[model samples]
Target: MWIPPPVRAPIGGAPASDRRRVCARIDRLVSGGQRQGWPWPLPPSGPLGVGRSRVRPGALSVGMRRRRPGEPLEPGNAHQTVPPLPRRAPRPSFYWSDFNNVAREVREFCEENGLVDERRLPSATELRFMPHPRPWLANGIRRHGGWKRVAERLGVRTATDVLSQPADASAPKLRRRGGPQKPRHYWREWKNLRSELTKFVCENSDSARYMPTVDELEAHNRYDLRYAIGLHGGFRLVARQLGLVARSSLIMRWTDLTAVAAEVRRVAERARLPPDVMPNERQLRQYGPRGLVDGIKQHGGLSVMAPRLGLRSQRHYPLRRKPRLFWTRDEADRQLKAFIQQCGRVPRVSDFLDAKRNDLLTALYRLGGLRSALERVCAEMDIAAVQRQDGVKT
Candidate 1:
């Protein structure tokens, strides 16, 4: 290394050993112990020691960063800015004015479209095209009850109000949304339904009280009448209100004993029994509907009704009681074994019910419970082994 004149002059006149030692000290001071064969200079031999790079501190880094010893550490650059959180959506404020605005919009829409009735009024989902805010309307509907209630409060016709009207007023059908509205059911009114029913009966049966059944209406293609009847109550209720009688119940006028007696005699003869001699009640049941038995009972009884039909009434005999079977444990086990054999295994209560073995069932119930009674029977008869051999669970 070529030393500067001023720096080398001091060592030039010294001894060889002295000059060599001075040059070594100058090299170490300039290099600061930096290693060779490296792109950048190595750091000095202490913690937080700056690297002895030829490049100046401010020049190597882009900024004028300088730190003195013993200062508090700070976070990354304060110059960086982050976008603030998006502003919160404003909470809805419910007001009657908002509700009324939506209602008026609906009303105007209905009027322009010739919707004079409540049944065909547009629902909330269908009101999207209106100018009023939908959220406010939804919240208002919830707060004030429901959509139907809100519509009613706003004086807009609703389905409940429209149902009781006698006839749906005909509106000029237009090609509107939801396919030209529901094909208006014209006879929705109570008075109109009754009159139509009366007219139908008079034309078909020529009897004012002959109320038509649902099947008759369906056969003649009067679906509207059936629907109206269901809405009011049902076929029976409507018939009762109009003083009408279905053909099924027309012959149910069992209050007249003379007519009832004649019917009974007719039924008895049909059953191949002698009509002159009063038939037993069991004989009449085979050839007649249940209503016949009910009617006879209503009039008085077979004894009273028989004489009126010119049939000689049979002598009434007092029924004698049969001997009651005392259900012993041995008797119960025998009956249960027989029942299990017939059923091919243990049976449920319904099996006893079906087999008409109420006495055994009563006795089983009289014992602790069915489980213990069954266990006692199985133990006494060795039935569990038999059941196991028979491939049935005991």
Candidate 2:
């Protein structure tokens, strides 16, 4: 009906048989050959169909044996090739065998550029390279310019190489700063003057008199005349100016002068006379001796006797009547001493009288009258006489 089927032409003009052969070869390469009896061609047993087969009896077929748990089945010998593993690129080799020569080149460069002192070149053993010595050298050179400049920059006047150098025979010897100088003679003189002044001030101060109060003499008997004399230097100088050495000496003797002056002042005050007027012996005798013996006996000998007599008052008083009068202080003193000696001591009022008697008599006699007068006189006179006479003796 329609035009005969379009005429067919072969592309690449290959025959079907050739294509089949090519496909067969590819199948053999990929899958191996088809199995004959055991899903693989068993090797031929010996000598055509003989009595005993050559194949071993217990041997396992490829399909019957369990491929060891995870193992892959063995491939046919023709197809058993492994692909190679990927590999890393190799590193380039560093040409370090020329290191010594490179070091030599560096040394030559340093010498040419004045980067180091040629004569002070470090030995090869000493010139060790750090991991990157060139960068360190470049940085050091940038910072300090060169080795000698670096040493100067670091305040090193003498190079380390110079320290290692032999000592110079022609160098000048160093002279050390000398020791402290001795003090001058005037220093000693000044010290001596200071010491003398200190001593003068200490000895001449008013405190040195040891007279802290006017009553000081009553407590301390030893007056320091040397200290008092030193204090009188101002007066002595005035006296000396007036050419009165004798008078100055008299005044300077504080003990003698003070005593005489005290006595004269007392007498003048009592007489109501001017200090220029002196007292005669009679007046002094009459006024002075009247109360003195009693005072001494009462105050010095029997100060404790007052309380024993039941007298509460500390006031001094005269005997109301004449006592058994001793002729002298010496006589009174002797009698007191003898009384003290005789009684094996003087008997106290408390010793002579019991407490009842002391209270009764003290109250009765203290009321005034003859008993009061008699008790007063007894207090003034020696206890021995009062005991013997028992009343006033004419």
Candidate 3:
């Protein structure tokens, strides 16, 4: 037997010209497709049966036109045929006749089930699970309106329909949960918070006079009361409400010296300090009752009061110093010159403030004001004089 070379379809059937035309049409459908670009020229959109023809490397040899069952094979490719592209099904649209049929079925089903389960109507999900499921009924219901509106139009009773029967305008709307509104938190109200604060202070503090700090509140895990404090005003206002005096207010007020002495001793006892150790005024203020430090001050100050409470005087207050004599003119000029040299320009009042030199500021004011003094200094140095920025005093 002779082994012949593989034979291809005739060139005239699916000719190169027809292939390029078909490929161009396909490229319009899918942009930048393999056949649409590279090596191949942008093809002319010629009708079937005419154009200059050329073969592509991997082109298929199917005839240009589809042949029906009885038609003879095309000329160029005798054996191969190109099936026509599939046509899409037309889009389904809402029609009254179809919708009425779907509605009639739904109504009949609802009527049959009504006696068994009152107000029974099939949901889309329920329709899908039925023995002879009708998908069109659900789709029709969706197209007409939502389930509720459709049910309402079809005389089906929803929960809202059963409940809103009374037409009284003044009738109170029912809450989702029955009964009066549930009691809000006590901290939500100032009066409630004050009472709660009284209880909290009495129970948690060393005595009735200690007000809890923010840190103490956080440590106790009662950060919720942070809201309470803001609603009722700050710690001092709250302490005043409770008949407790702030140490600052207590120091300024005159109270019985005997009571003050007694208060100091009481604070030392309950100070949260080491046992048998007495506290100074600072320590008593930190850990004792609100008025304790001031009480010590009222009874001849901390130095005198500490001995009575068996505490060593901490000598905590800053010692007073005499104000220095005003700076001489020469000294003032020397200082201003040095400052200008460092800055390379006349410095502003803000520069003095930023450097924390209020004493130098006082000396400048005393030396006949900033500009007058700086002008004298700048003149002596043979430099250009500077004026105060925007000159008029605020």
Tens-digit per-residue lDDT, 67-176, candidate 1: 32233223343443332332324544554446665566556656654454543444444333332223334444555555566666776654333333212133222221
Name the candidate that leads on TM-score.
Answer: 1
What is the C-alpha local distance difference test score of candidate 3? 0.55
Which digits, one per residue and each the tens of the lDDT, describe model 2 over residues 1-394?
0123322323134576643443344334324333323232222233112222212221121111212222322444434333333232342343323334334534653454343453443222122322112322333233333444443444433224443421232222222222111122322443443343335435543543222221232133313322333354533452343343323222223334334435434644686655444444444445443333233233322233333333222235532332344234344344434443545633344433642234323332334532333344446654433343343222
The stretch of ten residues in a row with the least summed lDDT in candidate 2 is 57-66
Q: Is candidate 2 or candidate 3 better by TM-score?
A: 3
- Candidate 2 residue pairs that clash: none
List, residue by residue over 110-206, the lDDT tens digit for candidate 3.
5543422455446554454344344456666666555666666777753333343122233233222221111335456777767766777777867
Q: How many backbone clashes are present in model 1?
A: 1
Predictions in order: lDDT:
0.56, 0.35, 0.55
- List the candidate 2 regions with Cα displacement exceeding 4 Å: 1-194, 197-254, 261-394
Where is model 3 more than 4 Å wrong at Cα? 1-182, 245-394
Deviation (Å) of 337 in candidate 3? 20
Candidate 1 Cα lDDT to native: 0.56
Cα deviation at 327, candidate 3, in Å, is 7.4
